[model samples]
Target: MQLKNAALYLLSLSLLALAGAITYFAASLRDINSSLPQIIDTVEKVNQNIAPLVAEAADIKKQIPAILKESEQIRVSINETIKEAEKLNSQLPVALTESKNWRILVPIIVKEAELARETLNSGIQEINLVRQEIPVSITRVESLITESRNIGKETSEGAVAGVFSGALRAPFELIAGIGNSVFSIFKSEEIILDNSDKEMILETVQALINASEFGKTTAWKNPATTRSGEITLVNATTIKKARCFNFLFKFNDQKPHSENVSTILCETEQGSLEVVR
Candidate 1:
């Protein structure tokens, strides 16, 4: 009975050891399985994060041509702005010169010419008055000489030779002397009229010469001017334009010297007169 009890006790101990080993292996296997799933989940999350980063990098590479095109446009716009500024800068000197001439010189020259022309017209009026008076004086002198000749012919020598010798001869001689004196006066005055006409013509010619010289001189000295000068923009988008210079008067040679000169001078040329004088 003792031997049978020892063998059953050993069998019981073996079965207990087998049950503990099986429980430990089952727990260890469960732990290993849970750890493997956690590792796989971590790898999947890493792949998701890395995929977005790669896609963003690819997108940035694709946009490079558009960015470069925008940069080139900006450079071209900057160059165009610089060229426009340079064109404006080049016109500054011309604008400044024009301003100086217009403000100070042009008006003053015009006023001076106007005053000179007024004085010339006044002189012309006086000359015309003197010229008209000369013809009337010449006509009166001629009529008086004709009357004296007719009276001397009517008084004959045959009917009144001895009867008209002393007293009549004295009266006739005195009459003849008076007529001769009148003719001498007419001749002298005719010469004076010719001289006066020549002198007046010369004086008027001088005035014309003076006016023409003044016009030429003024044109040379004070040229037509612009307040702002022309600006030329060289860029592709820029537009071109034209400008006109400012002038107080037309500066035509055909026009009269002034309004006053036109009234006095029949023709605009030098030495031109209305009457023979």
Candidate 2:
């Protein structure tokens, strides 16, 4: 009877342990069931992300032949490059020898270039010097021209005076040939005239003859010497390519003596007026 009681107690404890295990398994299964939708959603997302990778892998697999062909071409190119590298290596000694020749010439070429640069600099300096002197030279040339003009003017005036004196002397010489008395009277008048008075008379004669119209008269008086003169343009005529004019000059001296002279003057080729004998 005691053995049957012990067997019943162990069978009841095993039943309780089996009920606890079933309860724990049911709770675990409920948790697992709760997480199953999220796990399925994550798996769907993984599949979506892996879709492009799967397509790319397929495409890469399809291009495997072309990739192998390109790789073969690359290997051929690499082989050619290596052969060229070997050829270059074989020529390196010659190249180095040529480079040595270039190195020897390089300094010479550089020296020549330096010489050329110096020559250019010298040429530029010369040009600058010429440029600097240009204004001075031009000024000198202008000064020379002005001096020449002044000299020419003075020479022309002197020549005109000389010609006029010669012409007046010729008429007087002709008069002296005719009669010594008339020449003596003219000589006496000249002797009595002051140099300044003669110059004034000559200037007035030139001015009136050059500027006055025919029959126009111009007069001058010097109060200091009581000398007076009147010049009149009477007529104009052409003679052998020269424009000629007839002028009447009247002179009065301090003694109140008066003299009248008729003179013919011509414009010479030199553009100056001189008495015509």
Candidate 3:
């Protein structure tokens, strides 16, 4: 009876241990069932992310031949560029030699340029000097002309008066009177201009010569002297490498006397108009 009691106790202990193991296994199964949804979601996300990678890999496979062809073209271009560089390198020595030869002429070219500059400066100085001297020269010329006119007039009047007085003393008063009357009738009318009148006339002439067209006339009057003058541009020419023009000047004095004179004026290197003839 003791042996049967021991066997029954051992069987009850085995059943209790088996029941505990079944309960633990059932709880583990429940936990696994709850995490199944998360595992499935992680798998779906991995597939979605890998889909584009697979497509890109296929595209790279398809472009491999074109990429290889383009690489071959780049290699050919690089080789051509290298060949051109070699050609330029080969010619560099000849270019350097030619440049050295050109360097030998640099001093000579600079010397010639300096000489040209000096010549230009000298010409400019000469022009300036001429320009400064123009007014003085004009005044001198006018003075000389006035002196000559006065001398001629004095000489003519003295000779005529002496002849008339000698004829009257020789008992030919009637003849002298007739000769004087004839001389008076045939004597040329003179238009005497003062210095102020001359200056006004010259200024007008210069302005007209510079600004007036051909066949145009410009006139000036001096109120102080009641003197008037007109200058007309008639013809244009070149003389001694200077631009020249012919002008006709008509002068009127206070008296009923007038005179016409034709003169030629030329432009000097100084750019001033001067009487040429």
Give the TM-score of each candidate. Answer: 0.22, 0.37, 0.37
Candidate with top TM-score is: 3
Error of 1 at 102 (Å): 6.9
As for model 1, its CA RMSD to the true structure in angstroms is 30.6
Write one digit per residue (lDDT tens) for candidate 3, span 1-277.
9999999999999999999999999999899899999999999999998999999999999999999999999999999999999999999999999999889989899999999999999999999999999999677556544543443355445543342233222211112122222122212447555667766765665555433345789889999988887888785665775556677877777787777777776655544456656
Off by over 4 Å in 1: 1-46, 96-277
Ranked by TM-score from best down, the candidates are 3, 2, 1
- Residue 203 error for model 1, in Å? 46
The sequence of per-residue lDDT tens digits that candidate 1 reaches over residues 24-68 is 999999999989989999999999999999999999999999999
- What order do candidates take by lDDT, descending? 2, 3, 1
Q: Which ten residues in a row have the lowest lDDT in candidate 3?
A: 167-176
lDDT of candidate 2?
0.68
lDDT of 2 by residue, 37-98 (tens): 99999999999989999999999999999999999999999999999999999999999999
Better of 1 and 2 by lDDT: 2
lDDT of each: 0.44, 0.68, 0.67
